[model samples]
Target: MRNIKIVIEYDGTKYKGWQRLGDSDNTVQHKIETVLSKMAGENIEITASGRTDAGVHATNQVANFRIDAEMPTHKMRSYCYEYLPDDIVVKTVEEVDLNFHARYNAKVKKYVYNICNNKAHNVFNRKYEYHIPQPLNVEKMRKAAGYLIGEHDFQSFTTLKTKKKSTVRNIYTINIVNEDGNVEISIQGNGFMKNMVRLIVGTLVEVGLGERPADGINDILDKKERKYSGHIAPAKGLFLEEVNY
Candidate 1:
């Protein structure tokens, strides 16, 4: 078997999510798998580095699968480009070592969230960005994000209620930039649970809106309760930017 690694870019507005459900074909994974399986003349199952919520986009999501076919990697990639829908694109495909598992071998992931802090929304960007009519304090958001850096038990920031798995994750950095009326926040972390990025962004947004103080982030982390965190940010504003192995 040949282990192939593929990098994918997708505009996930229409899909239910990344994973394929038993009852529905409206998923990114199912869409790609259907095309690849046809090309390989066999059922193909690709393992992604992580899952993105519905409406969340991705610039460089990574995945890998083992194939028994003798087709060239470039040909396989070309087949995907021709068969997959316009919204999903396979950026690159290369043969990888047998030990390089997409999910287990991933070292870091970077997610970017965009907010249009303008009084009115831009027609072109309305689909991709979150609009906040009121002005935001970008500095406050940055200050609040500082408290979330480093390793922490992020139980409060995730929606996964089951405590059987570890909630501890190492957040390497949080970079917030404000340009004109656009506020972009980039978070680099070791790993994240379900809805973790959106929840963290929501907490920072509360601070930016003056609804919560920057110092309150530490208290939220200490509470270790999902209710203590702010509202979940809209899925449209979130993007999986990169996955580093």
Candidate 2:
């Protein structure tokens, strides 16, 4: 079996997310795997670097699958490009070492949240960006994000109810940049739990809006409760920007 890696970019506006949900075929993974299975005359399972939420976009999502076939990597890429939905595109495909596991080998993952902090939303990006028609205190949001930079248990920020798994994660960096009413919060982390990024963004947005104090971040972390965190931001505003191996 040869391990093949592929970089994928998708709008994710119409699909149900990245992971296949049992017999339901409304996921990106199911679509890609189904097409690959047809081309290779066998079942094809792919492991992605991360599973994104519904309506979230991805500029460069990574996945790898093992197949026993003589098909060239370029042909495989072409097949995906031709058969996959128009919203999903395969950016690159190449054979990799057998040990290259997409999810386990990922060193860092970057997710960016886009906010239209203006009176009027940009019609071109309305589907991908969240519109908040109010002036946001960017400096305050930055201050709140500082509290999340190091390793800590993020139990307060995630909606995951399973207590068996660890909620501890390390955040490498969190950058908030605003340009002409466009706000982008880019977070690089070792790993993110379910709804963790969206929850963090929501909490920071409250700080930016003066609804919550920046120093209150400490209490939220200390409490380690989901109710202490802010609302989970909308899925359309988030993007899986990159994954580093």
Candidate 3:
């Protein structure tokens, strides 16, 4: 058996999410697996670096699958591109070590949240960016993000219903940048719990909008309480940008 690794890009607006839901077929993984199974004449299961929430996009999402077929990796990639929807594309494919696992081998994942910080929304990017009518103080947002850069218990920034035993994560960086009317908050971390990135963005948004103090993140980190953090940002604005191995 040969293990194939693929780099993919997808606009998650039309699908439920990346993972296959048993009840629903509208998922990126299900779609890709179906196409691969048809080509290989066997059931093919692909493992991703991580799951992106519904309506969240990805630029370089990585996945690996093993197949007994002797087809070249490029042919397999082409076959997927030929069958998958236009919104999903397999950018590159290559053979890898048999034991290479996408999720387990991931060292760092980078996520970016886009915000339209103007009075009126940009029609061109309505589906991709979050529109915030209220003015934002980018400087304040940057300052608040600094408090989240180190390792800490991120229980306050994730769903309280998570089944994971540990909520601790190390954030390598959190950068807030503004260009024109678009504000991008990019974060790199070792791992994330469910809704953690969106919740962190929401908390920073509150600080940018003057609803919370610039140092509010410190308080949230110290308290480790979900109630103190801002609401979870909408899923549409978040993107799984890169996964570093």
Better candidate by TM-score, 2 or 3? 2
RMSD values for the candidates in order, in angstroms, are: 0.8, 0.8, 1.2
Alpha-carbon deviation at 30 in model 3, angstroms: 0.3
How many clashes in each structure? Answer: 0, 0, 0
Tens digits of lDDT, candidate 2, 25-134: 88888889999999999999999998997788899999999999999999999998999989999999999999999999999999999999999999999999989999
Superposed Cα deviation of residue 112, candidate 1 (Å): 0.4
- What are the clashing pairs of model 2? none
- 10: Cα error in model 2, Å: 0.8
What are the lDDT scores of the predictions, listed in order?
0.94, 0.94, 0.92
Error of 2 at 18 (Å): 0.6
Error of 1 at 232 (Å): 0.4
Give the poorly placed runs of model 3, Cα more than 4 Å off: 20-22
Ranking by TM-score: 1, 2, 3
Question: How much is 8 displaced in model 3, in angstroms?
Answer: 0.9
Q: Please, what are the lDDT tens digits per residue for candidate 3 over residues 1-245?
A: 98999999999998989984568889999999999999999999999999887899999999999999999888988898899999999999999999999999999999999999999999999998989999999999999999899899998888857655888999999988899879999999999888899999999999999999987787898877788889899899999999988
